[model samples]
Target: MNAPFPIRKECPPGACVCNRQALLSDPQADIRILKLTREEESRLLARLETLSSLADLKKMESRLHEQLGIVLTITPSIHEVRTLRGISIQLQEQPGLCRKTKQAIPAAIRRSLEKSPDIAYAILDAHGLWDGT
Candidate 1:
């Protein structure tokens, strides 16, 4: 039985399992790169530019620095705060489901970034927030 997906093998002791196809497809996956439209890229860039004050930029940088990873930058439905909060609580309880990596942070905090922060930040992005390069 060649399991292509990364499994902890100790989930809840009897957790219902699904997504065999996904595991078979992306077993041992490390990175998840996504392509974006020019407009999307520009919007993300514009948000970065809005970090005018050093304090704001520092906050952004700190958020990014503290990410568990698992990037989800292109999520369009992230503007929903309440939904994100629920997800956050779930994630906090299920820390074993996935490792916190640079990739996961963007996806997990999508709503928070879109609504409260209005700026996309990632711990893997770099040291500066408005590092417009």
Candidate 2:
């Protein structure tokens, strides 16, 4: 069966995080998957910490969608205004998505972080894994 979504080279070998093939093979299945490396996760978390308000987070999310063609939902705590830790991101993907769009997520995030003067160091994570839900 053909892969439902393109598998990125960044993902480690044998890392079948998302059963995209199953989703395509079985029309009833509705599952989309995205795998982020450790470095990507760290950079995303650090960038998130720098934001001052939910509005900023929303803006960033909008930018990601606009520039990278990736849709993500950021869950922030309502109690505290400044949330440095304990953040969850829901990356939205769909079956039969184009390969170019799938590959743009990391590059776009990296470019976004490079603009930050404080975030001078950015490395691609080699040992990142995604646990499919």
Candidate 3:
């Protein structure tokens, strides 16, 4: 997916933290499967359960960008993880973000979810993941 913003390197020269070499070789190729531990998955689901509205989830996205320079976009749909029987959600990371920051995005997302118990119940509830029962 194309980044909402223009694609440009966000890191400086010599000491590049944004995967400068790889990005320089191919700026448009940045598809990575971020694996989260089971504990982290549980925590993330727990936090997502607290959200009551889409507005709250939007707040979490903003928080991620503000605090971690990570740009995450929540799509309107979910996919099944065929291997794990778990659901997969879409999170888009824009180019030019530091590798360190990118790696920390999941943890940062969990933190954001903790503060966002007010958004997107209908979305998560589609798969019954947000059911209070």
Candidate 4:
């Protein structure tokens, strides 16, 4: 008598019993990079130049969502660290959303940096630079 070999079964992600939602919900699991064109970068800088208050930031967030489909949460922070001394920006999790960094800078930071073009210029390349750069 010949014995049959054990059968191997592979489960698809959708059919798997593992907690997929938990894995998918992890903010750090699916990091994405955002690339902006010259025109877009210029538009963003122009917006930043006029950012005067949280209300303006809200409008900017709405505009970004409509134009770029990105979710952003900008808030002022009082951290002792130089990098975090001004403000922080966070990209909220949403389907079809991919970003280079997880953080962002708030309007207050932009207002404060109005007098320091050098610092703003250094951080202008990418919004993520406000995190720790």
Instruction: Assess candidate 2 and give its lDDT.
Output: 0.44
The 10 consecutive residues of candidate 4 with the worst lDDT sum are: 1-10
lDDT by residue for model 3 (1-133), tens: 3444334434456554445456446745542222223344355445645554566666766764564344675533456422221323344545445454444544444444445532333445555664588
Top TM-score prediction, candidate number: 4
User: What overall lDDT, based on C-alpha atoms, would model 3 receive against the true structure?
Assistant: 0.47
Question: Residue 130 in model 4: shift from native, Å?
Answer: 25
Compare the candidates by lDDT and give the number of the best one.
3
Candidate 1: misplaced stretches above 4 Å?
Answer: 1-26, 30-38, 63-133
lDDT values for all models? 0.36, 0.44, 0.47, 0.46
Q: Which scores greater on lDDT, model 1 or model 2?
A: 2
* lDDT tens readout by residue for model 4, 1-133: 1113321122355543433344345665422212233345455756665665545556777876775456776544444324434545666664323222222234434554555545444443334445665
Off by over 4 Å in 2: 1-9, 18-42, 74-89, 94-133
Clashing pairs for model 2 are none
Residue lDDT tens for model 2, 1-133: 3434543233343543444454556855432333333455456556655654445656777865664345775343334323223223456766533344344543444344445422222111111112242
Q: How far is candidate 1 from the true structure (C-alpha RMSD, Å)?
A: 14.0
Stretches off by above 4 angstroms in model 4 are 1-36, 76-86, 92-133
lDDT comparison, 2 vs 3, better candidate: 3
What TM-score does each of the candidates earn? 0.24, 0.35, 0.34, 0.39
